[model samples]
Target: MGYPGLHRILWTREQFAVFRDASGQSYVVDAYCPHLGANLSVGGRVMGSCIECPFHGWQFSGKDGKCTRIPYAEKVPEFAKIKVWPSCEVGGMILVWYHCDGVSPTWQVPEQEEVASGAWVFHGTTEHFVNAHVQEIPENAADAAHLSFLHEPWIMNGVDLRHTKSKFWRFMKHHWKAEWQPEPDMHCSCLIVKHSLTIFGKHFPLLDMMISARQIGPGLVFLIFQHDFLGCGVMIHSVTPVEPLLQHVTHRIYYQRSVPSIIPKFLLWAESIQFERDVMIWNNKQYLSKPLLVKEDAAIQRHRRWYSQFYSENSPKFPSQNTGLDW
Candidate 1:
C-alpha cells in the first residue's frame, strides 16, 4: 500500500494511485503524473496535502488532484488537475464511489454496530480472484440447494447423507429460508437466510444458523452469521470488477472477543475452503441473464430484481407503502 505515501492499484481495467497525507487523509486519483506521465504513486512524496512528483518535483493537491507546484515553470496551468474519484474514509476502510453515468452517490455506507461495538476484533481476511462477473457472484446466496448439495456439511463428516434421503427428509435436514428486505429509496437490501445442518452427525443435534447479509449496492456485502455453536461473527465481503471476466474479492472476518478466538479462526479457515467449491464452478460457468428456474429458485429472481436498481437508468425507488418487513 502506498498510503501516508503512495500505493499503486488497478480496478475496472484502469491503473490508479492512492495517497494518504500526514493528517491521515486519503485520496485516489490517476496513477501517472500529468506532466511527464511518470507513475506518481511509486515515487511520489507527500508534502502536506500535495503529492510531489518524483521526476520534476511537480506537486499535485490530494483533494482536487491539481498541479499546485512546479519547480521550473513560470505558472501552474489551470487544466493541471488530475481526474479525482469521489472517495471517503469510513470504518477504517477507504471507499471510492463510482458511477457509470457520472452521478454522485445518493446513499451512504451505513455504520455497523458489530464492528463499532468494540466487542469484535478482526479475526482474519481471505482474498480470492474470481473469473466471473461481480453481479453473478452474490447470487449464490439465493441458491439454497447448493448449500445442501455442493457444500453439504455431512460430506465434511464423511457421511453421504443424500443417499439415505427422502425428499421430505432432505428438506427437513437443512431448513433454509431467504427473505429480501429492500430499503426504500436506497441502493441496498438485506438478504437474511436461516438454515441448519447436522455438523455432529448422530452425536449432537443440528447446528442452527442465521445469516444477515446487508448488501450495499452490488460491490459491498456485509454479513453477520449467528449460530448455535460458534456464536455470532461478521464478514465484510468486498468485490471490485477488474474486467468483464475477472473480479477481485476480499473477505474480512470479525468475531466477538468473548468467545474463544480459535473457534472463529478455525471457522474462517473452513469457510475459506468451502468457498473453493463455488470458485471451481464460477470459473467455468457462463452467465445467463434469463436462467431456467424451479420452485426453489424464487430467491434468485428476487435478488436479481433488487440488483437491477444499481444498473438501471433511474434512481432507486420503492413503493410508498411500507411492507412491515423486519431486518
Candidate 2:
C-alpha cells in the first residue's frame, strides 16, 4: 500500500477495493457499499480497523467486510455485509484468491526463495490489455516458431526454407524442445522450454534461451528466463480475464541484486520490443484447436493438455469460437 492508497481495481469483470489498515494489514472487498450501493473505494476512508463509507459514515470491518458500526442506527443488519476476498501478500505483491464455484483455494501460491532471501529486487512492471483470450498469452511461451519469425526477423531470412517450400520440413527446422510437468502433489504444472536461434548460418552460443515456468492456475504464470550472455531473471505474468475476449495482463520482472540497475532496465527494454511485436499478432490472429502439428510444434498440444486441467468441467472445452483448423 502506498500513500493515500485506496487502490481500486477491476478484476473478473467486477470492481474491487484493496486497502491496508493502520497496522499495514491488507484487505480486499467488493467496491460497492452494501447499504446504498455507493462505491466504497471512491470516497471511502480507512479508520483504525474499519473502512467508513463517506456517504453515511457506516463503517465495515476490515477483517471480514461485515458492517461493524452504523452511525445512524443502533443495530447493524445481518445483510449489511459485502464479499471479502481471500488475500495474501507474497513476493512484494498482493494476491487475491478467486474461485468460480465459491470454494476456498485448493492450492496456495508457492513461496519463491529468491524474494525471501533478498537476493532479488523488484525491477518494474509492464502491463498490456490484449484484445485476446487469457489462454493465448501463455501459449506463446511454447510457440518457438513465432520467436524466429516475429521477434527476430534476421533469423527468418537466414534459415527459412523458402526455396524448398515444404511446410512440415520447415517447421521442424527450428531448434526447440519443450517439456511439460504436472506435479500432482503441488496441483500445478511447470513448462520448461529451451531453444536456440541460428544467425548467418552459425549458432551464437549467447543466443540460446531456456525458460522455466510454473503455472499456478489459468491466471498466474511464474517464469524464469536464462540466457548465456544476458544473465537470468524472473518474471510473474498474471493474466485476468476482464471479459470473454479481453484480458488484463501484467508482467512483473525482478533481477539479481548484484547486477546494476541499468542492466535490468536494458533487459526489459529489449524484451518490450519483442513483446509488443507479439501483441500485434495476438490481437489479430485466430485461435485454432486442431491445428496441423509438426514434430517441433508438439509442445503446443502438450501445454494445452496441462492447461485444461485447471478449468472446471462446466467450462467450455475450447475458449474461442474460431478454434477449428485454419484450412
- What is candidate 1's lDDT per residue for 224-268, written digit by digit as tens? 878777788888888888765688888888888888989778867
Score candidate 2 by TM-score against the native: 0.82
Clashing pairs in 1: 2-6, 2-7
Model 2's lDDT to the true fold?
0.73
Candidate 1 local Cα displacement, residue 56, angstroms: 1.3
Worst 10 residues of 1 by lDDT: 318-327
What TM-score would every model get versus the actual structure?
0.83, 0.82
Off by over 4 Å in 1: 155-175, 199-206, 227-229, 312-327
Candidate 2: residue 52 lDDT (0-100): 79
Best by TM-score: 1
Scanning candidate 2 in windows of ten residues, the lowest lDDT window is: 155-164
